[model samples]
Target: MAISYDNTGRGIKVLVNGVHMKTIPVLLLEAFKNHHGKIAFDKKRRITPEERKLLHSYLVYLKWIRKLRKTEKHLYQLIKDTYPVATRKVITLDSERFELVLDNNLKIKCPEKIYLLFTEKPVIIHSNY
Candidate 1:
């Protein structure tokens, strides 16, 4: 997978297997006001580590969503509304793996890079929430 920031630096493009999958705005102001406590938005600066992790998790989730859409359209529709809205209970990242703990205590693991742009870095975590 490949990830790239838009020319305006306010959006991201996600590609899997060299195919574009999704694009989402950075929404720095909203993220700072809503999710990132004590963090400030800086258009002239690069994204922080936290933001990078968040983006990686989001891309993984999007990849899952696309797969579901192709294989199980009805199930995808049933869960789509809630999936993205599901709170992330925990997120861990490093150089070899990635893990996501969702609000329902379900965990997801990806040992390989889902986005080529973020190779080697791994994320892992557990959550009770």
Candidate 2:
């Protein structure tokens, strides 16, 4: 796990397995503030190649804009607010597949990369209230 501020000083670069995955902007870190406790990931087992790619794309979309799209925001809120009354609480977007487990903390646990990126240090939240 290697995360470093790029020489350009615009954002941080995340490298998984020594391969460049995403260069998350400084603003993106701030945008992640809302997801701190509401979302998490369980890395109890190995992450498959396809799952890694899926998570990579997801993060790309998440950091692309300052605010999350309404649909995306609603989706995550549902994951956070709902209880997993079923045996397996897995969620898949289109053809991509992944798993989500609502832990005792009530945080939705998905893939590790998403968890780590959002939980990265210096997550400053700017708000009026």
Using lDDT, give the best candidate's number.
Answer: 1
Off by over 4 Å in 1: 1-39, 42-44, 84-129
Clashing pairs for model 2 are none
In order, what lDDT does every prediction score?
A: 0.46, 0.39
Residue 34 of model 2, lDDT score: 31
Query: Whole-model lDDT, candidate 1?
Result: 0.46
User: Model 2: runs farther than 4 Å from truth?
Assistant: 1-7, 30-102, 105-129
In model 1, where is the ten-residue run with the lowest total lDDT?
A: 83-92
Q: Number of clashes in every candidate structure?
A: 10, 0
lDDT, candidate 2, 52-117, per-residue tens: 444454445354321434435665655533333212223344333223333443534344444433
Model 1 Cα shift for residue 45 (angstroms): 1.3
> Tens digits of per-residue lDDT for model 1 on 13-125?
43335544444466443333233332334442445676656655555656676787998887667556432322222333433334433445544442344333333343334
